[model samples]
Target chain A: MTALAEPIGRGGAERASLARRASGWLVLALVLVSLASLFVGATGLSPFAFLKAMLAGDAVDLRTKVVILDIRLPRLALGLLVGASLAVSGVVMQGLFRNPLADPGLVGVSAGAGLGAIVAIVLGGLLPPALAAAMGYALVPIAAFAGSWLSVIVLYALATRGGQTSVATMLLAGIALAALVGAVSGTLIYMADDAQLRTLTFWSMGSLGGATWGKVAAAAPLMLAGLIAAPFLARGLNALALGEPAARHMGVDVQVLKRVAVVTVAAAVGSAVAVSGGIGFLGIVVPHLLRLSIGPDHRYLLINSALLGAIILTLADMVARVVVAPAELPIGIVMAVIGGPFFLWILMRRRGLMMGL
Target chain B: MLTAETLTVRLGAHEILQAVDFTAHAGEVTAIVGPNGSGKTTLLRALTGDVAFTGAARIGALDVARAKPWELASRRGVLAQFTGVAFPFTVAEIVRLGQASGTAGAATDLTEQALARVGLAGFAPRRYHDLSGGEQQRVQLARVLAQVWEPLDESGPRWLVLDEPVASLDIAHQIEVMELARAFARAGGGVVAVMHDLNLTAMFADAVALMARGRVVTQGPVTAVFRDSTLSDAYGCKLRVNVAPPSSTFILPHAALT
Candidate 1:
């Protein structure tokens, strides 16, 4: 009773409020970017014209309607889902690893997922005919999830000791895993037929170009499961920042939390990579920016990262479509160009405070 | 009551703690004191379930090994020797993590209240990483304090299990921390602290458990355990305990050894 005084002017409350406020701004950005994406494709449908035609009850042309509804809508949906998944996965990974640099891409989860997708694509025929038929379109995403899940388990085992994660060990192991995965993927690529080769080439340069309702349906639930599951792990992840033993002391079920977090990351990253290929940097970039703006509380960080991630990736997708006109650049290229330099800047700024990496 | 009977901790092939029997009653401050590498920390960790140990440790009737983490956490708050925040969390935010709802639901303003108790009033906005070592340690203490703000809850008396709580504090702050622990004990809670400073231990502890080489060398009331022979033999040095000052005991390493 002696220490219990009047609690006043709490900063945590203010930070939480700021994070909540930012979500509104990010939602607005997402809407604006989504609208722009709908109208700014290579086919060039003017938004004003489309709205006017629809308002006037004029029968929109089949081609125009198809472009707007079928192509742009699914692409936008897939973009939002993949973007949110990547960003949320990044938050979870950083929280689990207790380091901001611990991104899915940086830690080779993306590469592992990529390997899974390549394996599924190149070896689909080798599967028992009945099993392959039953798996259908879900095969690639499932394979990718398994691959990412496996990689996370292996990485966690290697880099973590007595509940402390070694950033240096994680990064080096990531590079090593990526190299091994690349070699495996290369062997698979070499064996691919010409048709599979085209699919492989296009998929490697991450793009939302092949977005179909079927593809969206296939990947959405997996990513949605991950996105939904992440917020539940937010408090646990927050406690984990204080180290495993302390987190456990704080009533966090550290083992269960870690298991959920690993699965959530795999589910999100694996499916996102399956559909969008290796879309680099959205995971690290979005979460880092949100942390800088809103502070590192996962309660806010997870949701805000989802919103901002969707906004950024959608915006990136628009730029990818607009910059080259009919022949679009891969969104992956755009992200790497932006995120690579940004990552280097972060590394330089934080060189002094790697927290004993 | 918190009790650990025949507690043994083995890390790989090394036995960090061997057959350590310990007990601390509610409304008392029990200090575990010993020289370096005396297994003081390991014993505390075993009691707190931070380490895997072969022992029967109990908080009241709840067994340490079988009890869920939340079950134990609700009864006691632990302050580890070192806590590193991975991200740039504010002081208030870190402390808020100790609120009951830190695991879920909405949390009250206990964050600021705890900070004030640790002599860190109005430090809620400062980044945790920017604080000095002593300040950071106090911040962690504030967090642990917030976790079990009420010494005696409806269930029973809560506990403060601290490992070198004042290791990084200044002399004045050291007294402040000891006084805080004493206040908690006075308010019907038990406090178990792993201490290195024998003088502070003598001044504040109600009971003492002097340990050496993973075993309890002596355990009893402060007067009985703070004898010159017992202190000197356990610490492996000539330690002189002055009983001249009756209000608070003092232990000094003998200046001239025989």
Candidate 2:
């Protein structure tokens, strides 16, 4: 008997226990960061000032109140929603493919959503900005959902038959689709006039520049829905990590499972892109960090991923504001800079993980 | 009671299983043995409904191919080859999944008991992938053990199907798993396994189906499949079979007889 298997399993158990313990810490961290969001940047307000302005709405500067109430609050709310959403989707996506490298954008679902949002921006330009925002945001997710569904459909159509989905083939299809759609997005940029190009460019790189209460309102439910639904998937995913035939012999309905996993991932990731332009790294980072911390038990792994994603993004976006002072860095840029390196580390170290390791 | 009748599995244009007929009543172990690509796994998969095939497999009164998956799952528990190694699942959790084949409360308690039967009682928290190949096989057997170990329901008897369950196991675990399967049959459940080891098959299997190139060359008691003529015919080589003096049959390859 290899001592490694038991110890490793025990190690996973140990980490799961640790994750369960740190879970409270992460929740506290999010709460503290939520409070910190109110206090961060240019306000020069003491925590008391921040709290006073929030409770009484009688700050000396109305702009400070506006900054806290209108701007920061919505941003915090959207950041939390988008972060948790991406992270949950990432957990589901990586678990489904058993590939740690999989991310909404890396696999092109977000790019597809990006393309949808672009189309809405360009096509909806005929309407007013508010209407265009409504149409573009609405259509972004619908388009992203449609696009993601299409990519999944194509992947399934090409690689799956006889009730089997080939992970390798689906991944290759995602890579190929990402390149093709990315090229289309680039072409959309080239075709746009300078004015249109600016929004398109920002959306392309990803941003949380438009976190209205309305957008947050829209994203929160779907994000919450995904978060709530994720833990139930843990057992099925655990069975699946065993592989198609083994799972089947063990009496899992493999085809039904794949369908549920893909659709749920689409719903979670799609709604996220609707609110936040194309936040990168959150999805990939959340699940990988959780997996590293908690092992592959989807039961614990999924919930931990959600918590970590929420915490990391909330903190990241807060830092993005303070890093540059009054001129805020688009959070998409911040996440990419931080998340890109980690992505490389995962990719580089992944040969040891050929079987979705 | 479990039986497969006229089961034909077609792979593209080639027939992988050509009208294979087999049966195992509760209280017996049957080994489906053959060389690589000899339809051993194909037959087993077909019986488990892991593949679509043109034939009928019945567990008691329910036609296995047509039974609702949940219905069939309760009646027949299967453990295929130990190929997939997913990290992070403790030995207990994997076995717990097998308990899903039983009543809710019984599932948990039986899973614990099944692990102990395979000499892995204390290994509940061990990572499944971290185990050596043989130990992993034992754990998987523990899972199937949990599955079929369900006390009989009023509806149907439980069936155990394993495809190359011991292929990756070492000598000790091999005997452990085989004995476990044998005990399942003795306990009034049916166990049908596809095995590569003729010696082990001879030792424990109540009957054997010797297959070659998708056809059953001979199907009978263990004594019939172990004969010199059938052995030579199945392997396409000159072979010798001799009974050892230890009060049981022992087969040696011609190359090892020195």
Candidate 3:
């Protein structure tokens, strides 16, 4: 048995444990990146000074306190949650579709959420004032979450029949859905007043620029639900890598797995998009990079994706803040600028592997 | 034992499998052989509960349709005709998926042993997609083998339901795979394989179920079902079955002895 086992060649247990170890390093990177994010803003806030102020409790000035607590702290928290959400959603979507290229943004989930947000911004005044006040700041995120949830359910229905999902159909339908969403959003944009138009513009082009503790509190529950569901889904998703039937044969409930995966992706991506607009490529780019490194076993892939995604997106948000100084480029633009090339690099390097795609 | 009674499978407007009755006893290799559209694979699918069908299909006491997936999985492992991995997974990783249930007996780590059984020793770390068609098929076989490693346990005998288990392999590997199936059956497990090659089926299958257009033409032992006229009519072509010489180099009458 030992002789036979010797040639087994890196059993999954070892690789999974290796990924577990790798995640510790990723957590460390996330912490370092988060620290860098806190201090790498346009303002002259030094970490040493912040540490000193922390130790000497009453010495920090009001402006400095506001800069760290109200401004940077909320932004960092939102970035971490949103980044983790996007990356984890990407992992789930790709695993659900069994394709590395599948992303929430590509599948119209983000567009649907955008449509819901646009609807809220343009026609919010028409709502009964009391009800609108009741929903409070949560109205947009709720609407966005609903839109994304509906989008996934619709896409799933369109593509699945007899308990089987056709990846090709889901993707083509996603394109059509995105086009339809763009049309609807266009009409709403036309209806927007000047201030509403300004808000719409900022919302459509993604940003953490307006991050508040309230927004973080609103988004965290949905995103956290998705993140929590990911670990449970990891083994099933790994089984699903061998096609739906094979996974079922291996005792995975294929239909339940698909439903849970769809909901997880929708909730996470919807809430993130609701808070931060359309942060493209983070989903696709993060999971793909992690798979290339960690070998696509979702057990560790999902966790490492969360950690690495938080790190990368935090780093990108920091760059977005610092690149244009006090005037900020939307985090979406920064993501596209970096992620677009990285995605192409992946394509160029793995062109042979893309033959199936 | 595995049995399907009045099994019918419909796709869109057509009934792919029409009230097909079949049975395979424990500790025997039962082969399903037929023409291209004769529903051989569909029958296997129905038995495995991959497709919805009306009628009763049961492995042991568990109803295939009503039983939970894990319950069925613990009793049998299925080898699909074509299994594609969506992402890059090592051969070892693919085989380890079979161990996910942890029901294959006291020894949970059958990855290496399973690989060696399928002639895939030392091929574990190789990427599944990087392998040739035949190699991938064997890797999948290894995975299935790991899934139901022991032939019998406290519950009852396990089963291996395979669809076209060796459609792509060269003749040498084909023999290896068929022997693996035979050995599995000989170990008190049951194996129901959909076979394209009649000679291999004759050599390994303890019983044969012949079908024509979703209906069973005849089903019995190899000698009874592999008759010339029966096979010719079922396949819609002339097929002559000749008993090879006892000392023949390639074809042996080993199944006849069984």
Most TM-score-accurate candidate: 3
Q: What's the lDDT of the predicted structure labeled candidate 1?
A: 0.84
TM-score of each: 0.90, 0.87, 0.92
> Would you list the C-alpha lDDT of every candidate in the order shown?
0.84, 0.73, 0.85
lDDT of 3 by residue, A93-127 (tens): 89988888788775668878988898888888889
For model 1, how does the per-residue alpha-carbon lDDT over A1-357 read when each residue is reduced to its tens digit?
Answer: 111121222367777887777887778778888999899879988899899999999999999999989999999999999999999999998998898878877556788888888888889879999999999867876787678767877876787786655656877888898898889999999999998888667677788887899889888998999999989998898899999889889988887887678778877888898788878788777887677667789999999999988988888898898888888899989888776887678667655654433
Error of 2 at B113 (Å): 4.6
Better of 1 and 3 by TM-score: 3
Candidate 3: what lDDT?
0.85
Best by DockQ: 1
Q: Would you list the clashing residue pairs of candidate 2?
A: A5-B130, A9-B127
List iRMS (one decimal) for every candidate.
Answer: 3.5, 3.1, 2.6
Clashing pairs in model 3, backbone N/Cα/C closer than 3 A: none
DockQ of 2: 0.46
Better of 2 and 3 by DockQ: 3
Q: Where does model 2 exceed 4 Å of error? A: A1-16, A42-65, A121-146, A157-165, A338-356, B100-113, B151-156, B240-247, B251-258
Q: What DockQ class does candidate 1 belong to?
A: medium
Q: Work out candidate 1's RMSD over C-alphas.
A: 5.2
lDDT tens digits, residues A1-357, model 2?
011122234533465576577577677778988888767864555778656755896644777767777888898888877788888888777767766666765445675777777766666566677866666556665665566556656666776866677767777877788788778877877777887878666765666655677777766776677778778788778777767676666667777777777767766787777677777777766676556445667877787677778777887787787888877787888887877886677556553542335
Sorted by lDDT (best first), the order is 3, 1, 2
